[model samples]
Target: MSRIRIGAGRVTAEIDEQGAELCSLRYGTEGQPGATELLWQAERAWPWHAPLLFPVIGRMNGDRLRHDGTYYAMPKHGFARDRRFTVARHDATTAVLALRDDAASRRLFPFPFRLTVGYAVEGSRLTVSYSVHNPGPGTLPASLGVHPGFRWPLPGATDKRGHTVLFERPEPAPVRRVEDVLLLPERHPTPVRGRTLRLDGALFTDGAVILEALNSSSLIYSAPGSPRMTLSWHGFQQLALWSPPEADLLCLEPWYGLPSPIGSDGEYAASPGQFHLAAGRSRTFGFGVEVSPAR
Candidate 1:
């Protein structure tokens, strides 16, 4: 239950060591009477604030990972979100947490890897970075992702239907969907009209809407008369938009890997969009969030 706090300017963030999860993010001037929380506070509907996804993005087929003719139990979204991370460094506006593969993790993943997460705040923005290293003598097939849920309707907005997401560019490619946590092979028409997506509760009736081939690296979320948020990413090729039906939070996930496709052999390396890191090498991915409170 250990937590670390970091802040700069009008933004402050709280990260928990249990999962290196971002538990809270708020924006307000010093000594202000009201500071608006931009991140979701876990509620009865969802029990997580912002869980990191690693070694795998979504569910493996049958909730099992197959490697070299052996099957190991792997839960949905991998095990990183449930493991503890060691605090590597901390300062006023930055903190770094590290997680290394242990006996328990190796039993599940069968690889020796190191994962480091860094959080930094400056002005009104919070940037999260991830670095994964393969130390074993063989290639490591893995995935990394960030799942941050923001408060829907924002602080000053009354109508949830007024919210919209504007992309940096038009995303006309067909999007993907999931069935029972496994990815469906069929492609569906994009919900985005030009560069804008009108937020609606009905949109998540099935599950997350997965944009496998995202064209934009950044997007803005806003509602009339409410504070606005901008999310930008680097080294992430996929995105998922999700919220429980009628829930009060919206999750914007940027990912470097995907779930095992339905009807495929349960080979771990064959999972779609998996990254193959060579021994002694590393890869990094990151995203940034900037919030502007209503004036």
Candidate 2:
């Protein structure tokens, strides 16, 4: 129940010790609110949004995947995004949570390593960071990402079209759905720009969007009709837009790997899209979002 409050005006988060933090993409300076609610409502409202979801991240091939000479089970998305963590560091504008391999974790991920998440806020910007370290005798393959949802009404709930998701470029990407995940493919290698979209509840009927070909470095989530708040993504390779059917929030996931389509990639020999690191060696993959108000 520890909260990291930002400045007097905006951006804050309520993170549990496990590095499971939620960011508030709203105005008036309050942290994000969902994990607890989601946990409480999962059975009745979101039976599919479990808090302890595990490997391979982001919709694996047909609910199964290949990894390191063995095939394992992967939930809809990855874990970590939902597990609680222990506080590693904190002050006024920043906080860090960490998780190392424990007996419980070994049940699913039998690896000896640690994962740390850091979050910092300055002015109208909040930066969330993910760093992983290997401490065991061998290397491990892993795919990690941030699944953040900012309650819409972007600018401040004043303007109906007040919030917009702008793509830097406009080349069309293939919008496809995996068994449970969504993939945003590019028409080519480059992203398009100048295209802005207002999110509606109806767009996710088939379940997720993998955005490709974007020129804009950011995707702004604003208040419905006001310019009070906006959250943007700047360095993510693939942006996924999602939410449970009845929830009032939007999940903007910046990911590094997209699982192979269902019934495909039967061997999952390594982390779906993650590389390997040998004993004493380390590899890192992460993206950040800048939160602010709409202008």
Candidate 3:
């Protein structure tokens, strides 16, 4: 439950070590009324600031994972968020947290790996990076994603309708969804027309809006008179926007994989978006958030 603070100029952030999560971010110069909250308070239905998804992305059929020759029980989104991560290094502008595969983790995941997460604050932008290394002799198959929730209408805004998500390019692909957290094979036409989606809480009543094979790597969130945040990512294949029904926050997620498609074979290796890491090899995935005054 420890926290690390980092800042650059007028922008500052707080990272919680529990989930190695970014708990808070603020824009505006110090000692002024200009400071505004850019992150949600984890209120309402969900009480997490930012949860890192690893080993598994979404719900597995019956919460079971078939690997090698046995079936193991795995919870949705894996165990990374609930597990404690050790602080590898921390300073004024950057923090590095590390989690390693242990005996207990092996019983659940059956893989030997090391996960390192780093957070850096540069001016009005915060960069979050993840590196996973497969230390064992066998290949490691896993899914990774980032789920960070921002204030829907932002600070001082009264109406959620004033907020909107603007993509870097048009997103015309059919939007996929989940039924009880397991991804449904069918997809609906994207609601985004001309790269924009007007904020509406009702759209998330069932679950998240999943966009597979996105054409854009960046998206902008803005509301009238609020400091807008731009989310940019690389090495991610899917994007999901989610908000619990009536919740005041919207989660913009970058994912490398998705839940098992409908009627999956129940084999982990056959899962969609699962990354294979050769023994002793490492892979990195990252995303950044830049905050600025809305124009």
Candidate 4:
């Protein structure tokens, strides 16, 4: 997989052609003093830096999509993360990669669609944008998401347990969980107290904490003595926070869909949290991350 490097001011990003995944994001230039990497280096515990989720956000029932009375085997998070994208445009601080449905994609998704991902860096912020277009004659049922993992301890932080996620608004609503990769029907009390959620490994013993009723479009991930990062999104309806047990990374995910509910019939069109795109129409979603210096 080829990689493209883009930078502006103090931020730099490297994106891979395969999936157009962001492989690295740094806060300062190489060989400069106090340079820090904000993204997790795909270590032994997790093999992905950042993965783009398309067509579907999470696992489908029985890992199959039932459409028009036919079942197609679809992998968890769909196949966009594994497909090679064409570099549609590239410059010093911005790049766009595109993927159109081919014979291989149609076999799994059965839709004539085009997906494009764009990345741009300005100062200490990086913005990732997604666009999905339906070229087929029928409505396209799809979901999209981004899973980016940052360093657990973060730069300049002494302890990972001191990290916290501060939402822009109070999040007292209950959150959902996953079992066997399927969404559980029951809702659990949110761990957030007021607007803050303290980091803990035990919180992810089961799976990601799904915030289906998100009230805030932005949040700050911070730790004492460490640089803080603010994440803001638009056009996404849900959020998830996940980390592998004992791993040195934390993934902040913004999703437009949820996994198939337990005991679901695996129907594609009837699934929860999916947006239908009319023929020849397109929809766009985006999120931005801005890093601030530690106090």
Candidate that scores best on lDDT: 4
Among residues 3 or more apart in sequence or in different chains, the pairs in candidate 3 whose N, CA or C atoms overlap within 3 Å are: none
Cα lDDT tens digits for candidate 3, 110-199 = 889999999998888999999999997999999999999888778768778888999999999898999888899888999898899888
Candidate 3, poorest ten consecutive residues by summed lDDT:
30-39
* Per-model tally of clashing residue pairs: 0, 47, 0, 0
Could you tell me every candidate's TM-score relative to the true structure?
0.98, 0.74, 0.96, 0.98
Evaluate residue 18 in candidate 3 and report its C-alpha lDDT on the 0 to 100 scale.
84
| Poorly placed runs, candidate 4 (over 4 Å) | 30-33
In candidate 2, what residue range of length 10 has the lowest lDDT sum?
34-43
- Model 1 scores worst on lDDT over the 10 consecutive residues at 29-38
Better of 2 and 4 by TM-score: 4
Give lDDT per model, in order: 0.92, 0.53, 0.88, 0.92
- For model 3 the local lDDT of residue 219 reads 94
List of clashing residue pairs for candidate 1: none
lDDT of 1 by residue, 1-295 (tens): 8999999789989999999999999899733668778889999899999999988888887888999999998989999999999999999999999999999998899989999999999999999999999997999999998999999978888868789999999999999999887899899999999999999999999899999889999999999888889999999999999999878999999999988887766679888898999999999998999988664
> lDDT at 278 for candidate 1?
94
RMSD, one per candidate, in order: 1.0, 5.1, 1.4, 1.1
- Candidate 4 lDDT (Cα, 0 to 1): 0.92
